[model samples]
Structures are given as C-alpha cells and as structure tokens.
Target: MADSDQSSTDSPVDSREDSIQDSKLDKFSEDEETLITMMFNLVGERWSLIAGRIPGRTAEEIKKYWTSKYSSSE
Candidate 1:
C-alpha cells in the first residue's frame, strides 16, 4: 500500500520534470548562449541565478548546458 501510494505521487512529478527538460531543449535560443556566458562571468556558475536571468530554463537544464558547452574537462 505504501509503495503504491509512493508510485502514484511520483509519476506526475517525473512527467513534469521531463516536460520542463523538453521545453528547455526545444526553446533554447542562440541569444541564450551570450546571456548565459555573461551571467556566468558575473555570478560564477550559480545556476539558479543564471536561470532567473534567462527565461524558460531551469537550473538543472542550465547546469547541463553550461557544462556541456564550457567544461574544460571536455
């Protein structure tokens, strides 16, 4: 019963997370790269701050983007 309860609550949350990621991927604009870079320089990798500056991106998505685009380890 407890497992069923947990599963019922979790599915919507998982779907919402997936949709947010989809929206970010679909709507990412070329201008966002410049904005993200400038904000990173000012804030130094604080993802929520960067996401607030750029509409339509969650902190998680922005973190992924920044790492993928700018990671020195790559």
Candidate 2:
C-alpha cells in the first residue's frame, strides 16, 4: 500500500513538471516569432542608422522589450 501511494504521488509531480516545461517552450517560440517580425519591419528602414544610437542594445534586448510590450496585448 505504501509503494502504491508513492507511485501515485510521483506521477502527478512528474506531470506538473512536464506542464511547466511545455509552457516555457511555448513562450520561447512566441518570442522568436515576434522578434523575426520586428526585424522584418526594420529592414531597409532608417532604424538601422539609429540602431547605434542606443549603445549596447542588442537584437535580443529589442526582441525582449517588444515581446513583453506587444505580446501581452496579442
């Protein structure tokens, strides 16, 4: 009886961990998609010239800001 109870408890804990992993994976994919779109919008635009204005700003930082700002609305 003790072994059976332990097995049942462990199963749910494992499943919950899997759920968290899946959620994180989904968020990462969504962030990548948003970043790609933002990059396309900036292509051949004047933004490229001003990119250096924000010293040390990287593509990842730009993507994260836009994702946090825009993705929530979507």
Clashing pairs in 2: none
Per-candidate total of colliding backbone pairs: 0, 0
- Where does candidate 1 stray beyond 4 Å? 1-27
- Span of ten consecutive residues with least summed lDDT in model 1: 20-29
* Candidate 2 lDDT, 1-74, residue by residue in tens: 99999989998999999887545444545645554456547763333333443444445444444455457543
lDDT of 1: 0.83
Please list the Cα RMSD from the true structure of every candidate, rounded to 1 decimal place: 4.3, 10.7
**Top TM-score model:** 1
| Per-candidate local distance difference test | 0.83, 0.54
Best by lDDT: 1
Task: Provide the lDDT at 29 for model 2.
Answer: 50
Off by over 4 Å in 2: 26-74
For candidate 2, give the lDDT of residue 39. Answer: 59
